[model samples]
Target: MTFSKDEQPKNIPESNTTDNVAVPKNFLIPFLLLSLKQWNMHGYKLMQVLLDLGFTTIDSSNVYRTLRQLEKDHYIKSNWEQGEEGPAKRIYSITEEGEAFLKTCHSSFLQYQQMLQTFFSIYTNSLFPISNFTDKND
Candidate 1:
């Protein structure tokens, strides 16, 4: 059900659903950084490594674009590696900044994981009560 602006409840906040995001923004960043931290590799290999790690629904274009952005943001660095039997490949490695960012992301995700656990526990437990959630506006 869609709500028109005029018909929407004043007390309810605007919804920013997952639909607004093609994929969770940077959901793949830490994985990419962590992969680089472990072993520097070219884009194709990196994606393969990620797939091996059980990450699905990955878009190649988005991965390349994100890699370029990471390079621009100084989180990662790439250099062209001349292949013996193939064309040169751009090797990606995590910078110190990227490693630091990955650590931060790990910590934040742990906390988020806890919150999700709590949510699921409450959702699955019959002891849960809808009235436990009180509107701040009240």
Candidate 2:
């Protein structure tokens, strides 16, 4: 059968669902540890930091759960500080183990970044040949 250039490709299938599943709860541990590595913070401050980092949909319960897991794993330690105006807050800090783990995560993230750069370079170059062809006259 003949088809126009705008027609859908014969081999590709269409799907109606596009909603993305949530990132797993455990996924927040590394981020929490990394944040704590920079400074000791309470739950609210940590949540604010995460929100500022673009995690606006994160639930408070998830943050607290991750905090508990991190403490259980010995990656973080927390202490209660009595606030003058309100209830005591639990301040979290990264333990030595957490620092080491953060280093490993940082290295892995760097490698992943390099891999993504290489992949995109090849993929985009192949997809758009004109991207590599510069106008020398300019």
Candidate 3:
């Protein structure tokens, strides 16, 4: 079947619902640092918390890499804790600077949400105008 570049094959779905959409891994940095602010945890435990919080596709290496970058950037601090039966674990906690950074991130997130809301409103309204969705009784 020949199809133009702008067209999709008949069998393909046009849009994806929120439940099936995967959030990009880069979006988790703020969440990770916020969790650390609540309590210090090693990288593995942080990964587990992320998975529990619905970031199902997160990679351990990426988590560790982000943690390292956060530490290097002075947003977080870590210390080695002795383990009874294994190597010492590095536990991370949010620094004072991290708290300030988080506040900035929170503001950005709010603005981003508003931008998305505006975009979606225009997109859906364009695709399915209000008149088409109105109730017959009204």
Candidate 4:
């Protein structure tokens, strides 16, 4: 089935790549911290939990780097634990500071969520005609 441009619905937002939908930026922090808040885990387990949490385009290097930064900032703490069959693995857990930071993140993200909802509502609830678009010549 083909959709005609002229037949487009008024309330539908203009088409754009799905990539622009929700690009997670600075979200890796809360995700990692939040997980650690629940339980301690090794880097491997943390990475898997991030994948399970819907971070599809994440880089392993980036995750490790971020973890290092968080550790340096004293937001999180880590220690080595001997794995059953392999070498010791570094297990990470949220520090008191990390939990405090996570709470702040929750407040900030809640505001952002409201802003995003208001933004989408404009596209989904009302008609904004193409004719209203201002020309550069104006």
Candidate 5:
């Protein structure tokens, strides 16, 4: 059966829920704020960074929505700059509050990493039992 580019399989079911299925903005917001803390960037640049970080399925709308929410929360501030080729772009920068929040995020990330490492260590040890045999002469 030939299907057009926009067509989906017949067996697939569609949902009527209005809930957003995209990745939670909370996850990306901290990273966005952290990135902006390093340097100011517009939406496109932010999108590129997110893509480079392996977030290929992120929607542009979600990115903009997160940016707006961050701005509303006072975590980020934006300014408009006229570009030579196109319309003005809104550049975002992290605020002092954002920096503090990023610090907390960093700590949480480190703790998460440690927990994952511990889990892997236990799993590997259980999966492969290593034995150390002593010589009878010794």
Candidate 6:
């Protein structure tokens, strides 16, 4: 299933936030799927959860698009439910494949965290080179 250009969400917020780190696009699907594992929700609710989790600038369109993609990729599944007070809602749930994918994403995220830690260490040491810690023993 291909999402046409017009189908994509428009006018994404320019700034996510000045405080919290913005969620990377690659991590979006994993995050959404993980949340679905916790509880099934419709697109709007999913976007709300993401926004509440420090992603203040997330676009609903992007969230919906990601959901569609996840469904196409077999990482997630959805069912429409008729609402008592409003239109039907499409509820999303994580599939077994999604669970496996979430595990992979978690593993990769951990590795990425370790790499960032290593980089920070190198940066910190570079800024303040302790004489005793240098390769050349004085």
Q: lDDT tens digits, residues 31-84, model 1?
A: 899899999999999889877876656689989999999999999999999989
Worst 10 residues of 3 by lDDT: 11-20
Residue 74 in candidate 5, Cα distance off native in Å:
0.5
TM-score, predicted candidate 5 vs. hidden true structure? 0.73
Between candidates 1 and 2, name the one with more favorable lDDT.
Answer: 1
1-138 per-residue lDDT for model 5 (tens digits):
355546856553345454534444467977788789888999999988877765646778988998998899999999999989989999999999889889999999899899999999988877774543455576
TM-score of 1: 0.72
Model 2 per-residue lDDT at 109: 79
Ranking by TM-score: 3, 4, 6, 5, 2, 1
Q: TM-score for every candidate vs. truth?
A: 0.72, 0.73, 0.76, 0.76, 0.73, 0.74
Single out the weakest 10-residue window by summed lDDT for candidate 4: 16-25
Query: Mind giving the per-residue lDDT tens digits that candidate 3 earns over 20-119?
Result: 4556655788889889988899999998888787885777777888899999999999999998989999999999999999999899999999999999
Q: Pick the candidate with the highest lDDT.
A: 4
lDDT of 2 by residue, 41-126 (tens): 99999989876755646799978988898899899999999989899999999999999988888888799889999999988888
Which segments of candidate 5 are over 4 A away from where they belong?
A: 1-25, 131-138
TM-score of 2: 0.73
Q: Which stretches of candidate 6 lie over 4 Å from their true place?
A: 1-21, 128-138
Query: Could you list the CA RMSD of all candidates, in the order they appear?
Result: 8.1, 6.8, 4.6, 9.9, 9.6, 9.6
Error of 4 at 87 (Å): 0.7
On residues 1-138, what C-alpha lDDT tens digit does candidate 4 reach at each position? 235788777655357546434336689999999999999998878989888888766678988999999999999999999978989999999999999999999999999999999988887555675667779698
Clashing pairs in 1: none
Worst 10 residues of 6 by lDDT: 8-17
Worst 10 residues of 5 by lDDT: 12-21
Candidate 1 has its poorest 10 consecutive residues by lDDT at 16-25
